[model samples]
Target: MNRSEFLQRYHHLRQIDYEADYPLRKTGRAAGVLIPLIDHPDGLTVLLTERAHHLRHHPGQISFPGGGAEPQDNTLADTALREAEEEVGLLRSEVDVIGALPEYRTISGYAMTPVIGFVKPGPVLTIDRNEVADAFEVPLAFLMDRRNHFAHFIERKQQRYPVYFMPWQNRLIWGATAAILRNLSSHLCDD
Candidate 1:
C-alpha cells in the first residue's frame, strides 16, 4: 500500500480497541523498540536489526532497535527513539513518530512497547558494533502476508512456548520480534 493509505489505515486501527495478543509473562522491565517504515516507490519497507554475536542476551537474534527503558528516558516513546539512535544512529529528527501498538510482553522479561514510525529514506546509519551486528530491511507486504508466517514451539524445561518465524531470504525473523510483527501485520492488513 502507499504511504498515505497505510498511515490512514494504521491510525484508524490504533483507535480501535482490538484485542492484542500478549505473552503470559506477568513481570518484566519496561522496554521499547522502534519499528521503522520507509516509504518506497512501490510500497513500504520495515527496518530490522541483528544483535551482535557476543551479547549476553539474545545475541545474533533478529530484533527491532530497542533496549530496556532507562531512568533518563521520560517515556516509553523516548526510550524507543533513544535506543534506536544508540543502536543504529537513527536520529530522532529523521523519524516521524506516527503511532504505537499495544504492549508485547516477552518471555525474556521485557515489557516491550513497539513504537511505529516512518523514517526518511536514505538516512545513513552508524551501527554500534557492540550492540548491533547488522541492520536490514524487509518488505512490509511480505511480513504482513499470513501465508509467509510459520509457528514453532520452544520447549523450555517442561513447558512449550510458541515462536513465530518469518523467513526473509537467509534471515530468520522469530521470537518476540516475529510475534510483534505478526501483531502489527494483523492490525494493518485487516481489510
Candidate 2:
C-alpha cells in the first residue's frame, strides 16, 4: 500500500493481543523496537537490521533496531528512536512516528513494544559495526502477504510449539521478530 493509504488504514486498525495466545517469559525489562516503513516510489518497505555477531544476546539475528529501555528514555518510542539512531544512524528527524502494535513479551526476557514509524525515502544509514552488522529493507507487501509466512513446530517437554518464520532471500527472519511481523500482517491485512 501507499503511504497515504497505510496511514488511513492504520488509524482504524485494531490491536491484536499476541500474548493472549502465545505466552512468553517476561523479565520485567521494557524494550522498544522501531518498525520503520520507508515511503519508496515502488512501494513501502520495512527497514530491518542484522545484529553484530559478537553481541552477547541475539547475535546475528535479524531484528528491528531496538534494545532495553534506559532511565533517560521518556517513553518506549524514545527508546526505539534512540536505539535506531545508535545502531543504524537513523536520525529522529527522518522518521515520522505513526502508531504502535501490541506490546510483546519475549522468551529472552523483555516486554517489547513495537513502535511503528514512516521513514523518509533515501535516508542515509550508517551502520554501527559494534551493534549491527547490516541494515536493509524488505518490501512491506511481501512481508504482509501470508504466502511468505511459515510455521515450524518444536518439541519441548513432550509438547509441540509453533515457531513463526519468514525467510527473505538468504536471511532468516524468526523468533520474536517474525512473531511481531506476523502480528503486523494480521493487523494490516486481515481487515
Candidate 3:
C-alpha cells in the first residue's frame, strides 16, 4: 500500500477498542510504535530494531522501537513516540500514527500498547548502542504474506509454548513482537 492508502485504511484502526486483560510486571507500563516505512521503489516496509544483548528484558530480540512508559508521557501515544525517538533516533514529528492494536500480554509480564504509524523512509536513524544493537526495515509485503508466517514450539519451564515466527532476510522475528506482527498481518489479510 502507498502512504495515502495505508493512512486511510489504518486511521480507522485507531477507533477500535483494545482490552488490557493481563497484569503487568511491577506496575510498569510500556508503549511501542509500529512504524511502517514505505520506500520509493519497494512500496511498504516495516521498521524493526534488534535490541542490545545487555538489556534486562527481551535482550537481543527483534522488536519495535519502544520501552517502559515514563511519567512525562501524557498518553500512550506520547510514550511510544518518545521511546521510538530514544531507541532509534526517529523524531516524533516524522511519524503519522495510524492507530493502536490490541494490548498484548507478554509472558515476562507486560501490558504492551502498540501504536501503529506511517513514516517516510528517508530518515538516517542513529541507534542508541546501549539499547539497540541495529535497526533495519523489512518489506511489509513480505510480512503480510501468509506464506512467510510459521508456527514453532519451545519448552520453557515445564510447559510448551507455541510461537508464530517470521524471518526477514537475516533477522529472526519471534516472541511477542512476532505475535503482534502476525496479528496485524492477519487483520490486513482478512480485510
Estimate the overall C-alpha local distance difference test score of candidate 2: 0.87
The per-residue C-alpha lDDT of model 1 at residue 182 equals: 83
Instruction: Candidate 3: give the clashing pairs.
Output: none
lDDT of every model, 2 decimals:
0.86, 0.87, 0.75
> Number of clashes in model 3?
0
Clash-forming residue pairs, model 1: none
Which digits, one per residue and each the tens of the lDDT, describe model 3 over residues 1-191?
66665556554543343222334446545655555464545588889999999989778889988877778999778988999899888888888886887778776666677888878768779899999999988888788787998887767666666687898877899878877777676546544
Clash count (model 2, backbone only): 0
Model 2, 1-191: lDDT tens per residue? 98887877667646654523245543558999999999997889999999999999889999999999999999999999999999999999998998898788866768889999999899999999999999999999999898998998877657677778899999999988888988887767755
Name the 10 consecutive residues with the lowest summed lDDT in model 2.
17-26
So what's the TM-score on candidate 1?
Answer: 0.90
The model with the greater TM-score, 1 or 3, is 1
Give the Å shift of residue 139 in candidate 1: 0.7
Off by over 4 Å in 1: 13-26, 155-160
